[model samples]
Target: MDKIERIEIAVIGAGLGGAAAAALLDDAGFVAHTFEQAPGFDRLGAGIHIGPNVMKVFRQIGLEDELARIGSHPSHWFSRDGTTGEYLSEIPLGDYALKEYGAPYITIHRGDMHATQIARLDKSRLHFGFRLSDIVEQDDGVLLTFENGRKVLAGLVIGADGINSVIREKLLGAERPRFSGWIGHRALVDMNKLRSTGLDYERCVKWWWEQSRHIMAYATKSDGSEYYYVTGVPVDSWEHSESFVDSSREEMDAIFGGSHPMVQGLIDATESVTKWPFWNRDPMGLWSRGRLVMLGDACHPMRPHMAQGAGMAIEDAAVLTRCLTMTGVQDYATAFQLYENTRRARATKVQTISNANTWLKDPEDPAWVYAYDPMNVELN
Candidate 1:
């Protein structure tokens, strides 16, 4: 495919979502550029699930093989009792997803997925150390100002920045994301360490549901390591900041140190933990205004209970590329509207369902979520 020389798209915040959107745009022969706030490695922490809905998008973008190499398909999803470590229910994902959804339910480190998309994105199109400060709409396009006193212009802007999005604030109004009143504790255990305690590292994605909190553990990558996440009540009620805070093993011990041995042992083995409060934003009444639009967390951030964050952003990129198949600014408006119409309800449903069932979802959710394909779908 010949590259389109004239700039058409400007992606704000070169995280996984932004980078994936840029790559898909480039694949569509559009001149798409990206500006990122931080240097490399800004999103180096945490882990995420790459479900079939995500893989379906990746399959369309020609990167499923790489994702497969970096991630492993979970055999099943097991819901267990946090206090007793007894199974509550289970659903097969490894073979079932492949057979039903034409993709795998893989789990990988969030950083790995981000890095994969970044590698696929054209480096010449990426501008680093460019934090977005403001967006000024113009007759032909939008003028974006960066904190570094630089300006760039493109026919349209896509905000793939995370929950705290400056583009969203400028495009819409400033809005606060709601906290779920649970502090998240996350850590990665090397396969060696997991084996040291005979932990099941690759059997399934395990969820230990308690009253108001839960523990989720799964294999992060093929490198013989496990990624574990535990949700617990905050030590203090004074509204805790949602930023990830470095915490000690001792501090975590005060929370889950004495649960069932598997849960407690997992906490005890964690060398360090970064605790953060889970926060999510409700879907906006509108996702686009004129030439500016939003995607991923900027548009629809949901709880990790459903593990669709990365997949949703990638789906946004793929669908945006498909919708923005023309050159004119008028085409951008149509594309933006079509993108939002196609995505808003689906993303909102995931947000609502995940929030409703924090640790479990309806049996129909897997089919509704995993069997989705962005490429061949009709827009709402």
Candidate 2:
């Protein structure tokens, strides 16, 4: 029997990327287990927009109908001047989005999306609170040592952990997730309040862009709630800068102070605001080291400017699944190489776009990251 013949795959992290990978591996008949460092599943700040490319992957995972039911399809995307709040340009969504990309664009609260992924998974496959502390790849398989002293052995280990991935430390050395010097302040507000105020929430993702800052807001989770995410670019910070997570509301206010009223109003509406320090990694020449491999942020962490963080991760899962299903590939190293070859270029492009200065949202750049077809493209 060969290593790839009947393998047990272990995935770290339970965020969008990890969950998606687990689902794909399970569907492929691989014995897959997931280890999430968090003790329990909790929703993040607000909604996440899923473009046609990612939606297509969800469809392949058999969650398209459920995702459609739970997600809201916006009609357009609006860009506005950060200072005066003047409209710059608008991009049509929904039918137009579908027509252009072959799949509809949908936005849902992070919690709802998490729920949708959860519904498709078997309860026994995911292990919450399994924090990975160290990983060692051997000739036969990889051994994962958790912070709590529990260990798991598998033929393949995938690091789907977010910016701060422990599995990455083992494979790629102790590399830190660099800060983009931009802090994201996010919140979920009641849709009823937004509607009473007569704000057009459904037209598109509204962006109020200033010289060095931007506010992005959209209706999400059944159109009953609005999710707002703001990024305040810092003046002087390079890669590998320090950041503060779970930032206080006062700190958030201070950062956005003197900005647009619309942006301030959204911040005021949020009672307990959380801040995420953005980070990204340049495209590495290698995404796989051996039986141990990198997945999602572990391989290529990027800023959320183009909203491709989750989408790229989903794409990785799809292609990784494809590599695993290749017949006659008995050697795990060969399979790993194939997976890296197929994903490196695409993932690098995404990382490059995301790492760019998106605070300078160029109207000429039509966000090509959202338009990708996994089925048609040869990753290798």
Candidate 3:
């Protein structure tokens, strides 16, 4: 048996949600440690929209200004017809988001934002290359066994480990996430090639087609140096064993060719592209069991259509931290209950709409989502 180390809180999976949870918990004066499986991270080719809702949380953690400085502040989230370039809707952002939603909305490189999050964490408490392999719940605490021959007894555990969370499996049993019949092709376009078309691409836009197939494109930087896009296409099934597979410009043309000039320009700019299958799980009946609890994708995995998946996870981190602060680690059950009460309905609503892929497809008020202040919201 490995020597049993002890900790107050153990947060598994240092992804967006896990990192946020660890940060918020530490800020609230809790001794929390974050464990990640990967030895390190890479600057992957992907983009994410950070809604004002989540920016508020980032503000609480003191990262709002740095992120705002690094990310692109689009004037609006434009939805347009893929073939005709006809405007379907233009939802206000930029200054409008700052004034109305209590924070700024920005589209940024997912890797850049993630690196920023990881950088802000306490170095001593953040552990890399620690893959969680087994969990044992006890009366006073929980035992965590990592594959690296490390053992830890944590008073409380937060499973921000994502959809395939080992902690989640311990609670709900071993089951694979169901494929949502959707795959997204992600790519970062060659900026020079894109500019050669001489057509101005909006800072943030979603090109829509029939059957809900579309590409969400936006700049990842404030200076517009990096542009990225992710496409959602329905498929019969995902047979590939790898998480993602390579795709080519010809494949893109075959699927979205002869559309609008701008759409054609994007294909021409595509140098390297990869396609990934989206996996999902239904709304869980259990968000926590004893000292083990879950947040983000572990509790409510959804499609990324709404662009609020990470936002929800970060929000969960904030709220969970608040709950723990209220009840203290000794009363973890009450804290867990409050966390679920505060998060469930909202998370479920977002999950439902995200799976439908209808958010922001038409002009409508997004205040309910973008305006929510998780840091100050009343805990149930």
Error of 3 at 261 (Å): 1.0
In order of lDDT, best first, we have 3, 1, 2
lDDT of 3 by residue, 237-274 (tens): 99999999999999888888888778788888889999
lDDT values of the candidates?
Answer: 0.77, 0.74, 0.90
Error in Å for residue 164 of model 1: 1.2
Question: By TM-score, is 2 or 3 better?
Answer: 3
CA displacement after TM-score superposition, residue 85 of candidate 1 (Å): 2.5
**Per-residue CA lDDT of candidate 2, range 50-153, in tens?**
98888888988898778877777878777888778888867677897788877888888878888789778877988888888877677777777778777767
Superposed by TM-score, candidate 1 places the C-alpha of residue 97 at a distance from the truth, in angstroms, of 0.9
Q: Which regions of candidate 1 deviate over 4 angstroms?
A: 1-6, 230-242, 326-330, 359-365
Best by TM-score: 3
In angstroms, what RMSD does candidate 3 have relative to the true structure? Answer: 1.0
lDDT of candidate model 1 versus the reference: 0.77
lDDT for model 2, please. 0.74
Please state the error at residue 114 of candidate 2 in Å.
1.5
- Residue lDDT tens for model 1, 217-308: 88777654656565545444426454777877787677666677777767757877787777767667878888889998898877767777
Give the winner by lDDT.
3
